[model samples]
Structures are given as structure tokens and as C-alpha cells.
Target: MNQPASLPLAESLLAAPLPAGGPAWLDAARREHRAAFAAGGLPDTRIEAWKYTALRGLAQRRFADGDAAAAARGVDVAAFALPGVEGPRLVFVNGVFRADLSALEALPAGVSLQPLSQALRGDAEPLRFALSRPALVGHGREAGDAFAQINAARAADGVVLRVAAHAKSIAPVRLVFVGAAADAELAWHARNVIELGEGAELDLVEQHVSLGEQAQLATLVSDIELGDHARLRHVVVQDAAAGANLIRRSGLRLHARAQATLHVLELGGALVRHDLRAELVGDGAQFHTRGVFMPHGRQHIDTQLAIRHQALDTTSSSHWRGVAGDRARGVFRGAIVVAPGADGSDANLSNKNLLLSPAAEIDTKPELEIYADEVKAAHGATVGQLDERSLFYLRSRGIPLGEARALLTAAFCRAMLDDLPNAVLREHLSGLLIAQLPA
Candidate 1:
């Protein structure tokens, strides 16, 4: 990797003064992250990890730092909110927690929820400990990960949801992040932390959208920890503005016998990338991830997933489906690493994509690194278009060519969409997905 002589945007950000409050340790951490960003700089298309996605436009933009005190006017909650998936909502507009637009109804007992900005100002020992944990992210500390470092140094407002031991929260907690409605280009960074105690259970949902066509740069990070025997179901939906550059990364650590199920749907963005990593550190831990990414026009969407098996009898499975139409491009990279002592680990990864047009492109990379002798791991990827036989059969059955193509393409991604636990959300996503297809 070639280092640049100067980084104007990064230098401009670092020239500003740091936040006033926080403990000595946090200040030192921020300084370290800032220094790391300066040393590594922005990643270019030449890098292997970023070969498919380019950051030249993002680096050239002039963006001002986000202001938590800035009021978000004309925010319509009904537009972004789901029809029947309503309960315990937290809305953050331009990286600021909007209390007036939030609803904390039907919260279960033994659950504590608050904004991270408030906790950072007061005594937030738990948050500090969790953030400082070594196993929070598998490989985010590397110098080349500039976005992770920047987020660590500048994150201000986010959610902090913690469940007590042996408790269960049946209602899903929705975290909605809205971008700027104004035309000014703004840079917002936020970090959310979620912790579940032993024998605890909960459902979490996150949605990202924008109100205007502003060229906003939003960086969001999530840190999740599950105690022994804990269970969690996580879902994410990204449909930001047409000109937004969004980078959302999430890392989780699973303890003994812990289980996690994650579902992601990416439908809209100009340049969007998501990095999701999970570490199975204890015996009998299980991690499963599924996603669907569809990009059309001149849009670009990338999904990177890495799972590490560090203990015996651990298991992980990842399945992703993508569809690229028009002149759009899509990428999926999934990696599973089995440690030396992680014998009896089972891992499976599969990625299948469809190219709806001659101009569209899809790139799939599935890899498995196994150092253990007694592990079972398999990885595979496929990039192709709709089956001609199936299309012909549908057309022969009195269906038009366009309708048949759309039906087969939708069915190709239905396996992952059907696994979504929520009926209303699934139905809503199904409708939205079909509407985006080439009609």
C-alpha cells in the first residue's frame, strides 16, 4: 500500500479541538485513533480489501463535523417507520438523539436503555469497559481500517441497551438513523453498544434513511456482547439518500452456549459498505448471518463478513444473495477462520448472485482458513444470471417475458428473505424489493 504525501480532509478534521469531557483513558484512546488515521490515511482501489470499491469521491468531499445540538426540522417519523413493527423506538437525526421524536413504550422489565452521549458525560463505567474490551472487534485495530479509527475518535450520540440476567424482552427495539435534509454536506459518526447478561434474550432492529439528496457521509459502528446462554436476533435495513456515502460496521463476541441470528437487507445508496464481524470465543457458541443486497443504476453496495471460531464445538453459517441491474455493481466477501485449538468447529459459507443486465456486475469471494485438523468447513460462490430453462417454462405458461424474469429473480432471493422472523417487516421488504426489480 502506497502512503499519500498529504490527506487534506483528514488533516482538516484533526485540526479541530477534541471534545471537552470524558475521562483520561478516553482522551488517550481518541488521540491514539486520530494518530492511527493520520498514519494509515484513506484506502485506495489498489488495496486488495478495497479493490472493488473506490473512496475517491468520499475523500474529495468537503464535510463539516456533525453538531449534536443542531435541530432536525421537518422530520417525518411516519415515512420511515414500519406499519406493524412498532415498539420502543429511538430516533437519531444527523447523529443527534431526538427525544421529542422517540417513543419508549412497552419496554420489558430489568432492561436499561439510554443514549450513549448522556452516558459519556456522566459515570459510564460499563460503556468504558465494553469499549476497551480486546475482543469487541476481530480485526478493526489495524492501521488500514481508517473508518473504524475515525469513528472511534469522533463518535458522539448513539444508543446503549443492556438487559439484566435471566430476563427476556419480547418487544423489538428499533434504532432509526436519519441523514440531513439540508443540502450541506455533513460528516456524522456514531457508536452503539449492546450487552445481554446471562440467560437473557432480546430483539434489535436498525434502520438507516435520509430525507434529502444531500451528499452526507455517515459512519456508524455497533459493539455487541452476549453472555453465557444468551440469545439475540439482529436485523438491519439500509436505504439512505441517493447521494449518501454510508459505512456501517458491527462486531460481536459470543460467550459459551450463546446464539446469534443476524439478517441484513441493503436496497439503496450511492456508495454503501457494511463490515460485520463475529468472534465465537466460547465452546458451543453459534453464529448465523444472512443478507440480501440489490443495487441498480450507478449505485454501489458492498458487504464484508468475517467470523472467527476460537473455541471447541463452535459453529457459524453465512448465506448471502445479491442482484445487480442496470450499470450498478455489487460485492460480497465472506471469510471464516478456525483457530488451531478450535477443533470440532463447523463452518459453512455460500454466496449466490444474479446479473440482470449485460452492463451490471457482481463480485463474490468466499474463503475459509482452517488451522484445526478436526474442523468441518466449506465455502463456495456463484455469479450468474437467471436460468434460461425456468424463464422459458414460465413464458410458455402464458407469462410475459418481463414478468417471468422478475418472478424468477425474486424467487432466487426468497430463501433468505423468508428466514426473516417478522411477518410485517418481511412483507414490507418483499414489496419494496419487487418494486426495485427490472419491470
Candidate 2:
């Protein structure tokens, strides 16, 4: 396959040189993936996985390589502080690790956390399985998408976290990625590898923020593994600049009796997309996710989720909400599959969206495929507006029309965050959600 002539983004990225000097196996893997990306370029809307979100504008643009002054970038550390989270922290500036801005003191016992660049410098043997993987699993036909391939080829620094067997982290680990305004449009790639040993437990918070408005592109890929009897709680908050474009993909695998839960908020960025995939490879495994995406102005946000139940008695559930105002657009897709011989499996998904303006648009699709007998599966999606009677009632009570509309909109999105355990973080997130609404 020849690289598409319309895709200047891919041509510019592939022209940049990879980091020099690594183990023979790692180098070979990078070369192979780079060649693959050079051949395939980017996927278009004709592909089933990209039917809703188009990349024509992105394909016409060109971006520089990594940021050269990432280490010297001036950032206000106090701006990103959360109320209740005070654990070990790792901060990346334009995809490069910044030791001066990180807080790594008093790390909990049995937990090993470090930057991927540092780990690769020493004994990288432990990370071979994740780094050497050919393609992202569970993505079906889009497993070899261009973004993931380029990330595998060009990524050099990211989060590398591991927990020992039976160890429990008292405080949540925070990973922060800050995008600062650069001299020119640039592109950066990151790869994260996280694993929890048998009987381990952990809570993680991932954040993406921006310092100022800059036209840049960012791609990230994360691989997560949970062993038998392990548990994980993950949260993500994304608030990038309006001129930024962000793409991310995450793959998770669960063993026997393992459990994982996730909460996500997508609020900023000119163009943003997330692909989340999970597999239950052992019996009694469970996965749950709750999320909300609000796009105002001309922003575009898309979320794709896929789950597979490959073992007996596995369970999965998802609930998500979307709010689009102005001329913005929102897209959501939820897919669940029950493999053969996987009896007693249960799965359900629901997505509800609200459109606030005549010019705004929302696209949603819910899919389910069951190949096993005695399995329960269900999925649904809806798009509509706020109730007129509720708005009228609020106006009759002396509240201004604008305030009433904001009140109802806030309530609609707040339901997804009601069950969050952390009071401080929950309130903060709620405030952010309200701030993003049209006033």
C-alpha cells in the first residue's frame, strides 16, 4: 500500500527521525512499525471504525517533531493542583518528562513508578511484552490504525507503573501532561504501560491540560493489565486548548475475579477522540465505565468503547452522556461482544445526549454481538433536548431564563458523577462541567 498523497500529516511525521540507540529488539520493533505506518497512512471515514469522525482537515496540515524546549518551558505548577490528591506525581511537558516539576518523594511500599525513558535506559527486559506487541487488540479492523502505529514507533517517554502482589496504594497516583504553546505547530507521541500483580489494588488519575492556545497534535497509547483478584479505579480529565488536536487509545485485560472501573470527562480541544477497549479473559471478571463529553463552540469530541466477554460469568456495564451547544459536534459508539462458550455473561450499555442549539449535532450508535447461549446483552442510545416544562417551571419561580437553562443542563450531566467516592474531586469536576456550558 502506498502512502496517500492527500495525507501531508503522515508524510511530515514519517520524515522525522526516531530517537537513536536502543536495544536491538526495540530498534527492530520501531523500524517495523514505522514502515507499517508509512504504508497505511491514516484511516478515512470509509472504514467502519471511523465512519462518524472525518480527518480531512487534519490530513491537510503539517506538524513539526517533538518540542525542543520542553524542559525549559515555564508552567504554573499551582494551577493544576487538585484539592484531595497529594501522592507521588509525574508531569510531562509536551510529551517530555520534567523531573523538576514532579514530586516522587515518599513513594508507597511495593509500588514501582518511573518514566518510560528511565526504565528503557536500564533493564528494559521487563517491558518487552508490552512494547513488542504487534498491534492493539480488540479494535477489530482498525487495530492497525496510523496513530497507534506511529506512537509505537516514535514514543520515547511516558508513565511506567507497577504494583507488587497484594500491595495496596493508599493515595492515588497522578499523571499530568501539559501542552504549552510552542514556536510552531508540533506533534508528540506517548506510550504508557501499567500492570497490577495478583491481589493488588490501586487508584490512578490521568490529566491533560494546556498552558495556552497552540495548534499542535498529540497521540497517546496505554496498555493496562490486571492479574487475578486485582482491582483498579481510573479517572481521566481532558482540558486542552481549542486549537489542539488530541488522539488516544487504551487497551485493558483482566484475569480471574479482577475488577476495573473508570470515570472520564472530555471538555476541551478543537478535535479529540478516544478509543477504549477491554477484554475479560478469565471468569468472574467485571468492568464498568461512566463518562460525559461536553463540546461548545466549534469543537468536536468522539468516544469509542468496545468490550469483549471471553470467559464464563463475566460482566460489563457502561453509561455515558453528551452535551453539544453552539456549532459543536459530539460522537459516541458503544460495542459489546460475548464470545462463544461464554455462558452466564451479562453486558449492558446506555448513551443519552442533549443538543442545545439548532446548529449543534450529535451522533450515537450502540452495538451488541452475542455468540454464546444463555447470555444477557442490551444496548441503547438517545439524542434530544431539555424538557420545556421543566424550563418553564424554573422561569416561573423568578429565575432568569439563561440561569434556568444552565441549571437544567448542569443537572443532566451531573448524574454521571454522583457516585464518585471523592467528594473534593467530584465537586471540582462538577464545577468544571458547569463552567463549560453556554452562558
Top model number, lDDT: 2
* Model 1 ranges off by over 4 Å: 2-5, 67-69, 132-144
lDDT of each candidate versus the true structure: 0.83, 0.90
| Candidate 1 TM-score, true structure as reference | 0.95
TM-score for candidate 2, residues paired by index: 0.97
Could you give candidate 1's per-residue lDDT for residues 262-338 as a string of tens digits? 88889888999998999999999999988899999999999988899999999999989999999999988898999
> Which candidate should be chosen as best, given TM-score against the real structure?
2
